[model samples]
Target: MAIVLRYVDSLDFVKERFIGIVHVKDTSSLTLRNAINEVLTSNKLSFSQIRGQGYDGASNMRGEFNGLKALILQENDTAFYVHCFAHQLQLVVVAVVKKYDGVSDFFEQISLVVNVVCASCKRKDLLREQARERVQKGLCSGDLETGRGLNQVTTLVRAGETRWGSHFNTLISLMKLFVDVLVVLDFVKEEGGSLANRQQASGILAYFKSYEFVFYLHTMYDILHLTGTLSKQLQRKDLDILEAASMVRGTMEALQSFRNIGFAIILPKICNLQNIGIDLVKQAPQLLEYMAALSPCDSFAQFDKSKLLKLGKLYKYDFDDSDMIDLEGQLGIFYHSCIKDERFTSLKGISDLSRLMVSTGKHRDRKCRKMFSKLKLLKTDLRNKIGDEFLNDALLCNVETEALTKVEDEKVMERFEKMYAQRGQI
Candidate 1:
């Protein structure tokens, strides 16, 4: 199990730190809980510190009664559960596509094309070479502009079940390389090759040139474009729940507006959707109250003192009687000060207000993020197939690279020697 610690520091910045990974022999709620306890105990943290839970929509992880989410809530009720926004959007994409058989078949065809074109290094190289030549010719003929980031090639990216955003990337790259893909498929169809390969390529070439495929292609492009923005925003570290909620609302409205147009326009658009994050709020009244009160939107326009005070009482362990006495006055002053301050005025939305608040020295001190970008190296295709223990070791070293640099080389060598010496004997 991979553990991450997200907490607000004394400075009030929300920080997410990748805690070390824990190995589990099984994934029962109890077993998972114990693994969690072990990680926290080793780190000298406790259950009472948990403020929220986020996981993908997995039955074992987010199950209502016996899942790990419920088990944790049993220990800390204040630690509310939240389904991952990106995962929810991915589910939306999966479901919305299935609503129409045409859309479903479109994606299936896309997957098949990706598989056939990317089947071998020779084919991949052929596609790249063809795309490169086409772009070069266009650039020379003034049909394409050249710049630092413009007119660049889009390498075809195959979509996968594990990477939800892969569909978006695949759609875009394939759109850019549509001509190149057709050329590659045609070559495979007519080339001196096995009979089965020839037949499959010939069929794919025919599909690529069809009117139905083109219709579904543009339709999904528009739909995924809107949802893709939401997915990227949801994964941002600096983004808060309030900002995300607003973004989700905006995206849903845009999608609905797109749907409301006649079928002629809707031919290249999508319909059917569901409101997200509503259930989590419905499950916990305190959560609803907290989000309502904590919104620093409209220059503290939504600040509610009574609900905030109620939230304080709900999490009594974190707020003492003395703190409680002072919180109300502080909340009042904070709200008014933000309203009067020019720095807070003309802000775009909640995220801007959140950054301004954290910048002020008056807020609590919270240790937060700057290391997550380094985490991407561990998940790239070439680096993904790694064991948990080694993954954690790499994470620890990467997260604290400066600290690792300060350690003596001899000490590192001694540990490595000890680890490998036994292997050598075996």
Candidate 2:
């Protein structure tokens, strides 16, 4: 059973607000949907009463074809589904670290040793003692989560919405304690621990020593924050649609800065088990910025979906167009206009199957088949399914001019110039 929390607005209450945790069963099996139907049938709360819905980053809960959000939207167009920002940010960092071989190896090594040390009854005790010693030595004071040092490897990778900067501190602190952990492992080995234990410890130590691990720890912050920005927007309160649209616009603007970094190195490598060049690091930041910016383009759907899929591949998050039940037409218009510019069309091979085949398949001649097959597997379109109204919006575009008489315009311009001159900041 899964519990889904929904924010309900109360029109009759004094405070005009209510939040409820609807206990749902095996959401994967449609238990929650059945339950919701039963409740709505019995109570006065119709589909019209629902204002917002939130779920963890579970595929069954957010998937487009059959997830909880899909089922809800099918019933009521007003029930807006907001992806949990905290979860999105978590997935972002994991995607980036998974790219570099060195970083992946380092984390795998850390998890291997951390699991070994904390798995056994005796070893778990040793970890507690280590925690106590660290506390006594003033390195830490609270009951330390030794299990998470291994178990939360993925969680630690991403930043938080409210506490985005904590990810940086988590990495730094982990590195500082890494040596002390090895010392404890050595103590266990000399005390006649199993040979398997010694092997895991040595392997972990060697992995961390590599340059790749160190580089990953250093660069993780950029990717984590970049993702956190998305999470914050996705989870933003639904106070107004205009505000949400503006936030989406800001996110898109920020992501544009990341487009220069080649997709092959940063996004594709993270999404799949592909080898990436370390030199790609030089351009990843700007490229990541560009990737983030693309999120808000309503006509964004018209752009290459294969590219977006590759970008989203690393994480377990989904942004269903249908979920934007209210903004469908607007989104279509945004994406259609976005791709018409000479700049978007000029970007080379962005839609070329031959180039896509290079990364995922062996035969370039059969690239179209491979590309289509891959697209089908993900249940997505290669090109965004944008409508024609986006083109109409583009054609109808005109700067809305506020007409003023020449004398009025001069007076307004003169006052603006006087203010600007006083500032002397330009």
Candidate 3:
């Protein structure tokens, strides 16, 4: 499969207090090297500009002596490549859960079951039809159990620690409705194979009782709160989404004053997690150093795929395929809302403007220019309402421009000239 590099702009909860996209691609080593060099050379950003580098536990990105991190660090020794804490935590979760054959089997069975449920329009229609009938007949009808696709599974799994508990209901509720699923499974068996992986199914059901499972369940809430929306309450971090940025600044200043005393208090709390030998937890002092070394080039390379898969594995404990399915449905709803909802006009315009500003070189076509013009006009009105910091963030939305090759650079120039001439003709 051809994998395109996806760039996501997000906040670094532990360091830098700035939002930037971590770039990752799905190309070969040669392609990756060329792509990284192209981004660095074309953008005129030095290795010094990088404040942090984060990658999954992958040979390509994180190889100790010769991988992407090493190559970048050679260019700028100060570049602090931190293993993505989220990715590492995901790995730990997977390693912990896989101790029981049942958990692994559960994932495999759920995957198959989900496939059976959503196999086709015919199958989906049958499920809905049966569900409706069950409801009407006074039979207990519950959530439609299905397998989690990659995206759906990831969302629920990686959903911050606090949200996982809410999802527990979402999972067991599906299990309660499993009998209804067996009804659908009968249709699947008639069409093809049996719905349950009977051999592994019982073991998975048994594994749920393991102490590891219980401990994982206990930590899910704390983990969710830390990773998800609850971490926003860490007023000292000064993340943007927190209400009243100025007020947070004051709180941060107060924290700075108590740094020695605070560390005396907080070090013990941090050490608890570090005792397990998680590097990020141990390297708390390097937070600023890591931030100082992050680079724009890191934003365009292929992200660690295995790490994402690992996260999916960890997430499987609390979620199944239905959660993923619902996420997709929700995404579809959000997408349609962006396209059709009148209330989203201002938000949509801002999103478009942000995209236009980030577009670079030949990629910058008529649409971008038009959007920029409109954005420039809009800014005059929005400036007073939105603070400079917020406005700057909107402008910097595409902080890393399109990764262009030397050949692509020439093409971009040629295309720009043609478009420029065409505009002149008009």
Candidate 4:
């Protein structure tokens, strides 16, 4: 059990410090709480000093009645609990991949292939040699580019059960060394050290060379790569909650867009590879609809009115019930009223900082004044440099002039006749 603490330094920067890990006999709430208390006591800290706690969404840790969080809160009610974002992302990827039996089978076979190929030093050397030959041949034919970081030799990377990004790297490495892997698998099947080994290798090689496996390999590579990028961004220490919420929403939209049109984009490439027909495209697995609806809602509660409206539109598909729609309508009205209030808009820049300081309630010192003065100077400089013309241009750059207004939506269908006519040309 790794323990860490997050705190704000004198400079007003948030920092995480590593606390000593504790080994407990069991994961019960009492045991976990005792372990934590031991760590705190050894470090000369008190339970009352804890402002927040973050852990994975485990029953023993996050349970409402008898979890570590509850036990800690009993002592110090101010220690709020937050679920770890990185762990949540890993769970999301795991759930999405396991939604399809074929995807689960693909990962299982890939793991077996990695274990078989890298079981011995001789096989490892053979793989490296084969990969080197392939790179040389491709370079000579002008099919591969030569650069500092391009076309470097790659080794098999085994995917971990916990690390979501590892699967993306493993799939990418497999695709890069596809021919070498096939050659090694063929060798193992034809002449193995034992009969049982040869049989296993033969079965795996057959599955590895199949067109279905290839389809999933490419499909998951695209999907996992995007999620992996978002996961990395969320894991950054300096990431703000607002930015993380925006990234989560953007990723969901990208996934939804891919679900709607990715088959068309990937089909041509797959067909060119193995002369497959359109039937394969029709048989391709669709992304789960619920996956596109997943977003970090807790962080989004801090969003401004404009951002909230954009979020509502993005998640409008999930609000299938009247109750949800009504709730969202009320939320929109609340944010709209807040936006109309001049004081709220004026104080928006420092609201986040103010909230943070209020939570700690430690800004009654000189350090707080220094931080405030720096922010004031920054605001003054930004106001002086950014003119009305610049603001107007920034807002107008991406505005769609052809968009229909509220009046058109309320009127008859004929109001869009001209717009539909213009759209037909493209």
Best by TM-score: 1
Candidate 3, residue 373: how far the Cα is off, in Å: 24
Tens digits of per-residue lDDT for model 4 on 353-381? 44444454533421110222332443365
Off by over 4 Å in 2: 1-29, 49-52, 78-80, 96-100, 117-172, 189-192, 221-426
lDDT of 3 by residue, 1-426 (tens): 111122224221122222222233664444565566665566575555554566557787788787878877776665667564335434554563355454444444444555555666776677666655655555334333434541121111111222233434434434445555656666555544444534333443444455544333333333333332322343232332212222334433443443334324433333222222121112223332222221112231222333333333334433367655544444344334434544334432222333433442211221110223434754685475865556544544423232222246567667777765565522
How well does candidate 4 score on lDDT at residue 67? 88
Clashes of each: 9, 20, 27, 0
Candidate 1 lDDT score relative to the true structure: 0.73
Question: Candidate 2 on 1-426: residue-level lDDT in tens?
Answer: 222234312221112122112445455637777777666666656665665566767788887879888888777665667564445445544655666566566556555655655566776556556655665555344444444353222211222333544555555546545545666666666663678767766766666676556545544544444545555565544322323444545554444443334333344334322323222222222223324434433423335444444334322123244433423344344356536643334332222222322443322222110222332343336435633344222222211121222236567667878775555522
Which candidate comes out best when scored by lDDT? 1
Error of 3 at 416 (Å): 6.7
Candidate 3 lDDT at 153 equals 18
Runs in model 1 deviating more than 4 A are 262-292, 304-394, 400-426
- Model 3: what TM-score? 0.40
The pairs that clash in candidate 1 are 9-365, 9-366, 10-364, 10-365, 10-366, 11-364, 11-365, 11-366, 12-364
Stronger candidate by lDDT (3 vs 4): 4
Ranking by lDDT: 1, 4, 2, 3
* lDDT of every model, 2 decimals: 0.73, 0.47, 0.41, 0.65
Q: Listing every candidate in turn, what is its Cα RMSD in Å to the true structure after a full C-alpha superposition? A: 6.2, 21.4, 20.9, 21.8
Find the 10 residues in a row with the least total lDDT in model 3: 150-159
